[model samples]
Target: GGGGSTTVTTSTDTDLWKDIEAGVTKLLSPAGKVVVDKQSSNVLVTDLPKFLDRIASFLESVEGSVQRQVLIEARILEVTLTGEYQFGLDWGAITQAAALKGASTLSAGKILAQKFAPASGGFQIGVASTDFTALLSVLNSQGELKVISSPKLATLNNQTAVIRAGTDEVFFETRVLETPSLTGTQTSKTVNPRTVTIGVVLGITPQIGADGTVVLHIHPTVTEKRGEAKSAIGDTFPIIDVREADMIVRAREGQVVVIGGLMQEKRINNDSKVPLLGDLPGIGRLFSSTSQEVRKTELVVLLSPTVMVGKKVDEITSRELERLNKTKGRSPW
Candidate 1:
């Protein structure tokens, strides 16, 4: 019975082995190979369209990104006329002449004449016989005066002369006199004249905008140098009349703008001394001559701007640098 069971098991195992060999031969056949090749080709064929579309989309995206980049440049501007201009005035000298007409005595007139002895070409002094008291009263009442006429000299002889005042029609005769002095006899006469100086200074800065507009900033200063004064510390300093202003203006390229009517005025009070008598309460007004001087002036400024572009700017800047180098006779780096 054991032998019979062993033979049966052996027979079953042999049949199983035979079945496995047949399955392996079927799988290795040419028709099976064809089936595998067909499946692989189908997969490749199916994925190829999508892969090609992805590649096309990537190329389109790269092209569109490239198109978005752009190059940009700015227009340049070349500016000129950055400098200072000045104008000036002196009032102390102008007032001295007006005071001379009101002087009461020869001593007072001589004092004023000496003070204004340095008259130059632009101004002249005229003297005629008139009521000094009347002149003083009129000057005091009006607080200002204009010379109505100028004097002309006429020779009566070698030793005498006549002064004719025009329009006012006044005349005076003078005879030359000789006096004996310790050293020798000499001829001298006192003469007085007055003059004035006036000035103004302007500084400018300009900037150009991208849209062809210009912005201009200006600094203007007015200085009137009256004369000199001694400080309480015994230091001498200039009596300066100064006024300043800062302004901003806007205009189109190549347009001119005018800034005008900047005006200034100054008043100074001066007294000729009698020392303690001049300082005395109330009565000081009589001993000391109190006078007021006023000065006024006006200023105007003009500016223009031009815009440069492209090749013009390059050429101009290069030429300007070359010219500057030539003028300086050295390299300005």
Candidate 2:
């Protein structure tokens, strides 16, 4: 459309032919080397005839879709030309202009039809001159354009085929209609340990001395607490039950008893809870006088957004989802 006058001028047309010959020569010339037998070979040396055939093939290929001199016209304005096909239709310059207009690859087919389709007519094979002029003006003003790929109905057919083949089973069935921008506070409470009945032996009977005094005995007692998960507080937490075992009584005196068990006690001069050995009659004297620090632990529930509800959880509904998709205008049209 731009060089229509120049196309008719004989002197001006000579330059266009020269440019085409130069392009063909460049394509036929081995621009790079080919590796053969572990040795680098120039394309001109390796296959000059093949390169010539390629350039000739390209010239013949564009006969039906594009004119050979369009490149020389666009080259005068420093505009780049690219070849693209859409739904088997060729718009040539108009397609390039559409790409400059921020059209996507997905939109290639539909955009060609919309822009090239004649009004009050059936269909046209090539882009109209008026459309090319309009697109060129847009390109000159915008300096550059984007190409986008528009979604097509053919994808639906592929999905249907996959479903029929049993390869497209539904993995995630839930979809949020309106995503909540803000998160609601999770309501959860701490749970107390279930009341577990336990029998604790304090001490064995101690032998009395001649003056009716009782001797104290003691030994080291180890206690282990087993923790379990409980959901009594609307959330799961760990609960520990301190199990007491029989205490080793080293000695006893005058009806004073020695027993096997660990007891709970508070540390002296400190608020930290500590376990103290249970009192035994003569065993206290044999080892040392002590107090029990036996304890049973209850679960304390904590609410957090990162809590896992199931074994595997999908958090795409969370506020963090804004970073994942990052695309806009996802609504089906």
Candidate 3:
């Protein structure tokens, strides 16, 4: 045990090494020492044979080779209620129709119990990922459902996955400034072009435990460029609207969680007229008709997480990890 190297198998070398030295302090002799070589991913433990034997046994019990991966599937929707649903979406009826068979097992209580609208007491019911189609049918019957995005990605345990979809729209920012010139001070008007994305971004992090339970940290953001209007100073600018939410939930693999309660009202004007007659300043009223409509829409998100392992992990990576983690053995004399 004068000078030897032992590799960590379970957790990262840096994390395990930080606690190992203090944990075995009582067993250390004057010359005993344990150090980590992060570059080579090895832990060097130097001591007597008896002490080395104890360290070896401890490492054997604490370290193993089991790594997990996660697959995230997300669907974003916008629902516009009309006719019978003019007031708002009836989440209560939908939740009741699509019940989470073993709802008690999943921990989505407070997050799902949040109100979908100010006047409605409807709360979300737990739905298995596989059982969401039937629920979708029920939702369509309530309003006009629009699917905004469906993004999917895979990540290792304790890693974060980001899914983004949308486009960047151009705009102008104007500033009036006074500058010094060779003759005297001069007034200048400057126009700067700026861009903003009208799209959706979701940051999802999954932590899978050995028991097949997964804890998810979800953050979703969405922005829309509804229309354009003149600024106070007469500079034309685009009107933007944003809705976002952040939350954490726990559930077994393949469980579905729906996030809702975001609503927005949009105003649209419809004008119809005879081309030449409508343009006449004084008589346009005789040939032109104008109407306005207000639309109410709600944003809903559906997330489903599945714990991946072994062959499934390989399929996404397009390579086998078994060969990478294994190495030729070294004997301890």
Which number leads on TM-score?
3
RMSD per prediction, one decimal?
45.7, 42.8, 11.8
Poorest 10 consecutive residues by lDDT, candidate 1: 1-10
What TM-scores do the predictions have? 0.25, 0.13, 0.62
- Tell me how far the alpha carbon of residue 149 in candidate 1 is from the true structure, in angstroms, after superposition: 32
Q: Each model's number of backbone clashes?
A: 8, 43, 0
Question: Candidate 3: which stretches are off by over 4 Å?
Answer: 1-67, 99-130, 172-194, 225-240, 273-285, 310-333
Please write out the lDDT profile of model 3 over residues 1-333, one tens digit for every residue.
012111111122234444444434434445689876656857678886755765564444333212456777777777897998867666666665555532323233334212222332232334344345755676788889988777666776656677666676777888988889999999888899887667666667776655677777766666677789998778877787766656667766657777666666778899999999898999999999989999987766778888876322212222222221242233323
Whole-model lDDT for model 2 versus the true structure? 0.24
Q: How many backbone clashes does candidate 2 have?
A: 43
Ranking of models by TM-score: 3, 1, 2
lDDT of 1 by residue, 28-124 (tens): 2132221113223221112233333433343333333222211111111111111121122222332354346642221111112111112221111
Best-to-worst lDDT order? 3, 1, 2
lDDT comparing candidate 1 with the true structure: 0.33
TM-score of 2: 0.13
Of the candidates numbered 2 and 3, which has the greater TM-score value? 3
